[model samples]
Target: MKSRAYSAHTLSALVLLASLIPLASCRTAPPARPDTAPSVAIDGSTMYCTISWGKRGAYTLSGQAEQLDGSSYSVTLERLDWFNNWQDGWTEASVPLEGKLLLSEAGGSWTASKIEKPVPARTSAAQIRHRNTILEGNQAADLFDRRLERVRATAAWLASESSFSPADGNQFFARAGKVLFPEQNGYPEGTGQSAVNAEFKAGEGMKWNRTYTEQSIPEHLREVRDSGTLWRDWEESRELFYIAYTWEK
Candidate 1:
């Protein structure tokens, strides 16, 4: 157990750490889209797959384009495999990097109009202790290039009606979960999809229920477990945690 004095010191250290970090190093806007047809096209003819590396870490971006109509297409993209490079090797970490893009045809050429925003990447309080300002402007630029290229390739694959295949996010998640948690049986009670959905519906009338999925029950449980207060808290306030985790961020 952490002493109250130690906890107070930790809080002070976190405050100081936050003030020391530079804003630019912590967050950045996505790179600008090139004006060329190939870079913005949704005609199913170009695809790019590439890795972007920075002093702090590396990530990969790829995408696919699906023709929605004669003038529009839907593009799905993924930025995956975030890794922090260290002296020894690399450490895998979760980072938000999946999104969709909408494109429209104009002047006999396809062009992307907007891209859906993915969930924001976050740094945990625990991580802030050891994290440094990341130099990643070039990395973001590389991701932009790779996204256009991959979209082109996937669009090319869909050029022929016989080859058209749409991407399904849920199916992808199911397959990924199998590989990531091979031994996992199922979600805990009240944590299943339907149960969680019902919990949300019930909380729709509650003023305090600011629906968000970032603060999930599993994450809460993991935090408490790491802090050696899981069992104690579970017995004292399990239901409260469940409802709070279910309906609020």
Candidate 2:
């Protein structure tokens, strides 16, 4: 009976010790670390950093420099969370730091390391011109002689009370003795035409007789003429027509 009791107690002790072995191993093991530093690059105004851990996962840190100093920049980092959604992370962190930083597996939770200075990408002149063109609302120099011809033809059509034809393809037209100019790409199209129509139909005769001369030209148009690169042969008197007529009695 005594031998049996001792044997039972020993069996219980062995089981408890076996169970605690795994817990002790877990406590003694160190936390996993990344194999290498993050990769960093810059494009335009944005900076990107890529970091990876062995078998754990990989993540990217995107940042923008809000302020630039000598050899360093105050950057704002955007990181992806565990769910892989982008969110704002650190703000105004000095980058290109000298030491390692603790990065958390969860984004926006860990400290980021310093990155190398980024090189500014070169932009082409043609790209600049295209961007400017878009910003300028697509207004180009209407220096073609056909523009004046179209104006004259529209004036004739208005006098004769003829139906407009799509074949004419004239950009400018006249109705009720009011010479109309189409809006440029950047400018509101048909707005000028609508205003002229409204004025012509109000009451009876012509309300205003306006002339567009060199002195009357807008500053931008004059600049276009001076540049002579985009447009040429701007003759205000010949291109712009005078409309003088009263409503029929």
Candidate 3:
């Protein structure tokens, strides 16, 4: 026999797969009914799920069981958030579990029979045009040269913010429903936006050098809302502030 080594990425995938194994192969004998819970009380039964990604951290899923029947149930789960162990906190939005899962108990664990997942959200051509229009009016220079790294940095920061915000995880991070430019991370108050902003700057090599409170400043920004596919997905353009502007030194 020969020894083998697995890379961190490979090990993470393995762990995630292992966590899902029980969901697929669950089996069990008839369960004892509790005196307090009725036969169909499963409708309101909630389940919390966590999928570990080894060093990457884990994803949390939760939802109540609906349309219960015997050991069978229809579960509509929403991915709560992604905890990035590397960041010591939630850092990304996870694709929400889509479709009603037809679940059944086999080995004392609930197993999904049929499931559907949503596709990732992408910036549409229309959205790009709208963003361009706004920036154009303000004579903002496009950061096309650093698009790749900047976009990647932007995505990570946005996901991290979404994971940390107490507001609707599916909506874009905003202040009073608006994206404030050049401010200290325009999130709700007392939510440690400064801490997150520091991390974003240090880790991503991006920082805001100016601030504006005038009402006209917002006119130069575009807020495009779209369908969100994950807990980390952005529903508006405010979530992509980095992509929208390239603050020059």
Best by TM-score: 3
Once fitted onto the true fold, the runs of candidate 3 whose alpha carbons sit more than 4 angstroms away are 1-57, 86-97, 119-249
Q: Give the per-residue lDDT of model 3 (tens digit) for 1-249.
A: 111233566445434532432122212212111111111113122342332222333323334555455566665654322222121111223333344445555544444433544212221111012211322111211221122233344444443453333233234334423333333344344433443424221112234322222221222221211111111122222222322221110
Greater-TM-score candidate between 1 and 3: 3
User: Per TM-score, what order, best first?
Assistant: 3, 1, 2
Model 2, residue 183: distance off in Å is: 80
* Cα lDDT computed for each candidate against the true fold: 0.32, 0.25, 0.30
Q: TM-score per candidate, in order?
A: 0.23, 0.17, 0.25
- Highest lDDT, which number? 1
Total clashing pairs in model 3: 6
Inter-residue clash pairs, candidate 2: 137-186, 205-247
lDDT of 1 by residue, 99-202 (tens): 66565657755444345643323322112112443333345334423322332222232232242222332332343223212223243234344324432312
- Clash count for each candidate, listed in order shown: 10, 2, 6
Candidate 2 per-residue lDDT over residues 40-132, each given as its tens digit: 333333333323221222222334443233233344443321101012111011112222222232331223343432211111110001211
Error of 1 at 161 (Å): 45
